[model samples]
Target: MVLHDLRKYSFWGLLSLAINLMYTKIIFPCALLVRRPAHIRILGSYSIGRGFTSGPGLILDVLNDNAELLIGSNVKLNHRCHIGVMKSVKIGNDVLFASNVFISDHTHGSYIGDMQSNPLQPPNEREIVCGNVEIGDKVWIGENVAVLLGVSIGESSIIGANSVVTKDIPAFSIAVGSPARVIKTWDKAVEKWVAVS
Candidate 1:
């Protein structure tokens, strides 16, 4: 652990940290910290509150001028987390995201709408269908999780690793698995998480 810490805090690491400080203060004044080497392409707008920090390789993409992404204060996102917004994505305060997590508010083509994109067309060339995603405060999203379009993750919830959240997760719950389901919910009186029976 000590050796790993030393390697992580090496000269290049320190330089990256310094550059991030400048980037936050000057370039992106909304965020308190954004680690360097992040692939951020925001044609739209985003507002991140103070004490927002992200690890290296954080990818934030806002595809169009109408898109908006809002993140509250003291949110921490680990390495390689990607958030792609086409309409709106609001993340509340004190949220945590583990590595390789993806949160997107849009998909390549419309499946439910009448004006669907051509199936013969490439996905990259297809029209984008927009949605909205809202993540409440004090939510802990585990590694490799994908929070899909039009989903809402309520406050004080935990999403297990490798899960794909396709629907709304109620507050004070523990959800897991692909197409994530609420496996347990917090019982305040018992002060424990009781399994969904």
Candidate 2:
């Protein structure tokens, strides 16, 4: 009886191992092809399902419980995007995100660092801030854009490269500078967009 149980467990273990290997090499690359030019920022692509749809490489952390959302069908995510997906963050379709884009939903569980001093040392945690971050369809997020928590960017808007977004921005608006102020909006009547002129 013990021999039979061992065999069964070994079979299960091998199956799981095969499955993991398949996703890392085969399934993931195929998904990326579905959306050409798009890349993924992963939270836990191996075990957890936090990753992109059809794109390039992604980075995610399992211990932190951070999730990654796909930008669009075809997007490119450069390296070093610190996405805090402990909460919910959604990106729309046909968007382009530059390198070092911070799409975080939660700033560490506490205000102070969560990393302990030593293996046995206690932790110091403060209030948690978890909110939803949504980027609209066909939006462009520039490099070094620090998107704060609980902010929603409307559809068809252009976010200038290296801008800081603090509050919610309306659709078809051109926001730039620190704290990302809405300089103008897209005017279909004039066939041209207007900023705060």
Candidate 3:
């Protein structure tokens, strides 16, 4: 049993070293350790801090040349997480994202502005509307969560799985549901999470 455990650990350590070398040569310096099959398409300016790691099948796309994407240090994104940016998307330090999470800062067309999209025009050709997204430090985003444009998730907030966040989430709050609403808040007084009234 001991020999088998040692072999398993050795294999993993060697695999991690190989992956790190590949990333150092092919990807940016911020990719400390990343699993295989990551599709990163960058046409914009970006910066990723130290100790950043991503799981397999991660798609990070920055579509526009003027767009900017910033990811802080010690962030981990699980498998199949997609972040598509056309404007600006800033993620703070110590953020953790579960699998299959989608975060985008732009939509295909605008319905509220003067240059509204026409049905006659193809959806792909329609003008894109940009709304920057900001995720504060120490935020934990669950699996299958879609964080849309113009949304700001506050620091240390917890977003439940399968939730669609459309608006701002306050700091130290737990939010859930589609168009996620805050259900619990960290009570600093009691040093615990309490129901939000």
Q: Write the per-residue lDDT of candidate 1 for residues 47-152, one digit (tens) a residue.
A: 8887888988999999889899999999999999999999999999999999999999988988775787888999998877777999999999999999999999
Q: What TM-score does each of the candidates earn?
A: 0.88, 0.63, 0.89
Residue 43, model 2, lDDT: 47
Return the clash pairs for model 2, or none.
Answer: 31-54, 32-54, 32-55, 37-75, 38-75, 42-60, 183-195, 183-196, 184-195
Off by over 4 Å in 1: 1-8, 112-118
lDDT of 3 by residue, 90-144 (tens): 9999999999999999988888757788988888898888899999999999999
The C-alpha RMSD in Å for every predicted model, in order, reads 3.2, 12.9, 3.2
Candidate 2's error at 195, in angstroms?
Answer: 1.9
How big is the positional error of residue 59 in model 2, measured in Å on the Cα after superposition? 2.9
lDDT for position 78 in model 2: 56
lDDT of 2 by residue, 29-121 (tens): 533322222233454323222243322234443223454444455444554555556566777766667767777666534443674234233
